[model samples]
Target: MRYLTRGLFWIAVYLGLALFPCLALLSGNMPPGYGYWWDFSLALGYGSASMMAIMFFLTARFKRPALPFGVDVIYYFHKYIALLLFLIVAAHPAILLATEPVVREMLKPAQINRYMAAGVVSFLLLTLIVVSSLWRKQLNIPYDTWRLIHALLAIAAFILALIHIEGAGYYINTPGKRLIWPLIMVCWLLIQLYVRLIRPLRLLSTPYRVKEVIKESDEVYTLVVEPRQHEIPAYKPGQFAWLTMFYSPFSMKEHPFSFSSNPEQKGELRFTIKELGDFTKRIKEAGPGQTVYIDGPYGAFTIDRHPAERGSVFIAGGIGIAPLRSMLRALADRKDQRPHILFFADKSLEKMTFYEELKALPDQLNLQVVFLPQHPPANWPGETGYLNREILTRHLPAHLSELDYFICGPAPLMDMAEKELHAMGVPLQNLHSELFDFV
Candidate 1:
C-alpha cells in the first residue's frame, strides 16, 4: 500500500510536469487567435514537447518511484506512450499544414526559416525513433547501436522542439512566462543528465569481479561474481540488474539479467544467462577477475513481496527460470514449509538449466517440480509438448484464486498463461510476471 501511494504520487507529479507548459503558455498575455485550428495545432505542439521531455524520467530507473509498478512495467509504458505521443507530434504539423496556408508556404525552400527547419527535423527524428524501436528486430539493427541512436535522436528532438516553440513566440509573451518556460526545460535537461551522464558515473564507484563461469545447460551459462570494493546491494529473490562488463560504463552496452543464485548468501552473486543475444552469446568468454558494474536489483516478480497464505505456483518457459531459481533457493535456505509447484517448459531434460538442482530441490523445501519438455525421450514419464490450457488444468491445484502465481519466459508463454489463468478464476493481482522483452 505504501508503495502504491508513492507510485500514485509520482504519477501525479508527472501529470503536473506534462500539463504545466501548456498552462504557462495560457497563463501569459493572450495572443489574438488566427482560428480554432491554428490555436489547437499550437497547443498540440506544446503538449507534445512537454511529453517528450518527460520521457527521460520514465526510463531513468527511478527505483523508489517505480516500486508499485516495476521498472519493466515502466519500460513497457514508455514504449506505449512513445507511440501515442508521436501521433500528437505528427498532428501538430499535420493540422497546421491542412488548415493554415502560411504553414505550407513556410515549408517551401524559399520561405523556410531556422525555426521551421527545427520543427521539421524534430518530427523526422521522432518518426525514426518510433520505426527503429517498434521494428528493431525486423530491421536487424544491433541493440547497442539502436540504443545510442535512440537516445541521441530523442535528445535532439526535444531540444529542437523547444527551440521551435521559443522562436515562434506565440503565447508565452510575458517576462514571467518566459522565465518559467526556460526553468522547466532546464529541469528536463537535469533529468537527461542523470540518465545519460550522472547515473553511469555513480555506477563506476561499485564494481564486481567475475569469479567463474559455469555452463548450466546446452544453451545457458551461469556467470559468478563477487563484490570487489563494496558490499553487495540487498535484493529480492526475483529481481534483476543491468550489468556492464568488458566495456566501459559509458559505452551503453549494458544488459539486464536476473539473479539466479540465492539472495540469502551475501559473499557472491550469480547470473544465469542464455545464449540468445549478442551479449549472452559472449558469456562463455567471460573469464575470472574481469570487472563488472551492476545497476539494479529492480523488478517486482518475487514471492517476498506478498504473504503466500495458500502456497505458490511458478510457471516458466526456457530461460525464464532464472529468477524462479533465486526464489526457490531462498525458500530452501529459509526452510519455508508452504506448498510450492513449478511447471517448467523446456526442450528436454538435458537442455534445461539447473536440471540437477531442480531434481534435488523437492527434498529441501515443500516443492514439486513438473517438467514439460517439448521433446521427450522414449519412455519419459513427465508431460511432453508445449504448455497450454489442458496441461495447465491437469497440474494446477484446486482453489487457484488463493495461491500466488509467477509466470515468466517467452512473451507468448507469459501472455498465454496470464490470460488462461485469469480466465480460470485467478485474480489479476495474484499473477506476477517479469517482462524482459521491454528492457
Candidate 2:
C-alpha cells in the first residue's frame, strides 16, 4: 500500500510537468516562428525542475534519512537533485530565448512585455537563491540569517513566477491547465499558511507552561515544561520536538531540541539545550511561567520501533547526549531489562550534559555509562580520550552484529563512530543516525 501511494505521487508530479508544455503548444494565439513545440519542452523542463526543488526542501525540512531501500540514501538524493534542478533551471531561459524567436521579440519594451519582465525578475531571484546557497559560507552569512533570506526570496520567486505564467496567456487559454496549476499553487500556499499561522494559533489554546529550568552544565540547561491543560502526545525515547520560546508562531525562530527526559512522564516535556547560537543562548535565562509552543514528535530514531533482541548501543558526544539521555531515562522508567551500553565522549566532565541523571539510571535498568574525556580530572577513573575503534570494541557487545547502534552528535563525531562501527563488523542496517540540521 505504501509503495502504491508513493508511485501515484510521482505519477501526479510527472503528469503535472508534462501538462504545462503541452498546454503551451496547444494555445492558438502564438505568433509565427515561435516554435510552440520548443516552448512546450522548455515549460516541461522548468516545471519539473521546480518540482524537484520543492521536494528537496520538504524532505530536508522533515529529516527523512532513508527513502525506500532500507538505507540512508535519500539525503544524498536530495542533495544531487537540488544541483540538477539548479543547472536545468539556469538553462531554461537560455533555451527559450534561443529556440523561440517570439520570446526574444516579446522582450522589447512595450505594454505587452510586462509578462516577460515578470519572468525575468522571477528567474533572477531564483538564480540569486541558488548562487547564495551554493556559496553561503564564502558570502559570510550565518545559517539562520541565510535561512530567513532564502525563505523570503523563494516566496517572492513563487509569486512572480505565477504571475508570469498567468500573464503569458498561453497555458491560461486552456481552462484545464489554468485550473490545475492555480489549484496546486493554492494548495502549496495553504499548507505553508497552516504551518506558519493556523497551527501556531491552535497551540496558543494549549500552551506548555515552563515549570523549571536547571543548569546541567556550563553551557547546557534543562527546561521542564508542564502541560497547562491536556498533556502533549507521548513521544518515543529518541524523538525530538520543535519549540518556540515566544508564543508567536510567525516569529520565524523555532529550534528542534531533543527530549532529555523519559517518555513515561506525561505531565511535562523536558529539553536539554546547549548555548550555541542566538536563540539557544537565551534558553538558560528563561524563567518559570513562560509559555512555550511545542510542535513535533518528529524523527525516526527510537528504540520502541526496533526489535528487542537487537539490543541497543548509544553513542553520544558533548550535548548530543540529549537524545541518548531520553532513551536511557525511558528504558529505566519502563524497567526494561534489555542490554544496552552508552559511550559518552566529551572534552571534559564539566561539559557533560546530564552527569548525575545518567549515573542514577543504572539503578533501574540494565545499562553501562562509559565517559571518555579529552582532559582527565585529578582522579578521573573512566576512559580518558576520544571514542575510537579501540574504545568502541572494548565497550561494545562481544557479538557486535547482534546490537543496533544509535549515534548522534557533532557531524565529525557521528562520522567517526559510523566508520569505527562498520570496521568492527556492524552491518549498516544495524546502525541508525539522525542529522539535526535543515541543510
Candidate 3:
C-alpha cells in the first residue's frame, strides 16, 4: 500500500511534467486559434517536446524517483513512453500537413525555411533513435556505440525541436509566453549537467578495486570489489549495480549486474557475470586491485520486500540465480528458519551455476532446492525440461496464493512462470520479476 502511494505520486508528478506546457497554452492572453485541427496539432507538438525533455530526467538514475518503481520498471516505462511520444510527434506534423496546405509547400527542398528544416531534421533524428534502438541487434550496431549515439542524437533532436518552436513565434509570441521555454531549457541543461558531468565526477572520487574473481562454473565468474575510499552503501539482497571496470564512469559503457553476495558482509560487492558478450566477457580479464566504478544497488526483486510468514518461492534459470543466491545467502546468514523453496532450471547438473552451494544451503536454513536439469543421467528422479504449472504445484507450499514468488531468468522462462503462477491462483502482486536486459 505504501509502494502504491509512492507509485501514484510519481505517476502524478510525471503527468504534471508532461502536461505543464500544454496547460500553459491555456493561460492568460492566449493567441487566437488557427483552426481546431491546427491548434490541436500545435498542442501535441508542445506536449511531445515536454515529454521528450522529461525522458532525460527519467533515465538519469535518480534514486528517489526510481525507488517507487524499480529501475527496471522505470526503464520499461521509458521505452514504451518513447514509442508513444514518437507517434504523437509524428502525428503533430501529419495533422498539419493534411490540414494546412502551406505545410506541404515548406517541405520542398528548393523553398524550405531554416525553422522548417530544423523541425524536419529533429523528426528524422528522433526516427533514427527509435529505429536504431528497436532493431539495434538486427542492424548489428555495437551496444556502446549505440549508447553514445543515443545520447547525442536525443540531445540534438531536443535542441533542434526547441529551435523549431521558438523560430515559428506562433503561440509563444509574447514575452510572458516565451519565459516558459527558457525555464525548460534551464531544466534540460541542468539535467545534462548532472548526468554528463556532475555524477561522473562524483563516481571518480570514490572508486572500487577488484578484490578477486572466482570462477563459478564453466562460463560464469564472480568479480568481487571493495571500495577504496569508503564502504559501499547498504542495498537490498536482490538489488543490482552498474559497474565500469575498463573505462571511466563518463564512458557510458558500463554494464548492469545483480549483487551475488549478501549485503550482510560489509565493504565488499560481488557481481556474478556470464561470458555472454563483449562487455561481460571482459570480466574474465578483471584482475585484483583493478579500479572500477559502481553506479547502483537499484532494483526491487528481493525477498525482503514482501512478508514471508509462510515462506516464499524463488524461480531462476541459468545466471538468473544471481539475485536469488544473494537472498538465500542473506537469509542463511540471518538464520531465518521460515520455509522457502527454490526452483532452479539449467541445462544439466554440471551446468548449474550454484549447484554445490544450493545443495549445501538446506542444512543451514529451512529451504527446499528443486533443480530442473534439462538433460538428465540414466534414471533422474528430479524434475526436468522446464518450469510448468505442474512442477510449481508439486513443490509449492499448500498456501500457494499466500506466498511471494521471485522469478528471474530468460524471457521465455519468466513469462511462462509468471503466467502459470497467476493461473494457479497466485496474486499478481505476489509475483515479482525484474527485466534487466536493458538493450
**Which candidate leads the pack in TM-score?**
3
TM-score of 1: 0.97
Give the Cα-based TM-score of candidate 3 against the true structure: 0.98
Ten contiguous residues minimizing lDDT sum, candidate 3: 168-177
For residues 1-439, write the lDDT of model 3, one tens digit per residue. Answer: 7888988999999999999988887788887889899989998999999999999999998888898788888888899999999999999999999999988887789988899889999999999999999999999999889999999999999999999988864788668779878889999999999998998998899899999999988899999999998869889999998888899888887888999999998879999998988988888898999999998889888888886688889899999999999999999999998899999999998889889999999999999999999997769999999989889889987789999989999999999999998998999999999765887
Off by over 4 Å in 3: none
User: In candidate 1, what are the lDDT values of residues 1-439, reduced to their tens digit?
Assistant: 8777888998898789888878887874777878899889888888888888889888989887788888888888899999989999999999999998988998999899998898899999999999999999899998899999999999898889888887874787788877765886888888878877888888888889999999887778999999888989899999999999888888889999999989998899999999987889998999999999999899988999966788899999998999999999999999899998999998888888888899999999999898988899899987998888898898878877899998889898899999999999999999999866773
Give TM-scores for every candidate, taking all chains together and pairing residue i with residue i. Answer: 0.97, 0.84, 0.98
User: Whole-model Cα lDDT per candidate?
Assistant: 0.88, 0.73, 0.91
After TM-score superposition, what is the CA distance of residue 49 in candidate 3 from its true location, in Å? 0.2
**Highest lDDT against the true fold, candidate:** 3
Cα error, candidate 1, residue 43 (Å): 1.5
Question: Which candidate do you rate higher for TM-score, 2 or 3?
Answer: 3
Model 2 ranges off by over 4 Å: 1-43, 49-81, 97-112, 142-144, 169-173, 379-381
Tell me which residue pairs clash in candidate 2.
none
> Model 1, residue 87: displacement in angstroms?
0.6
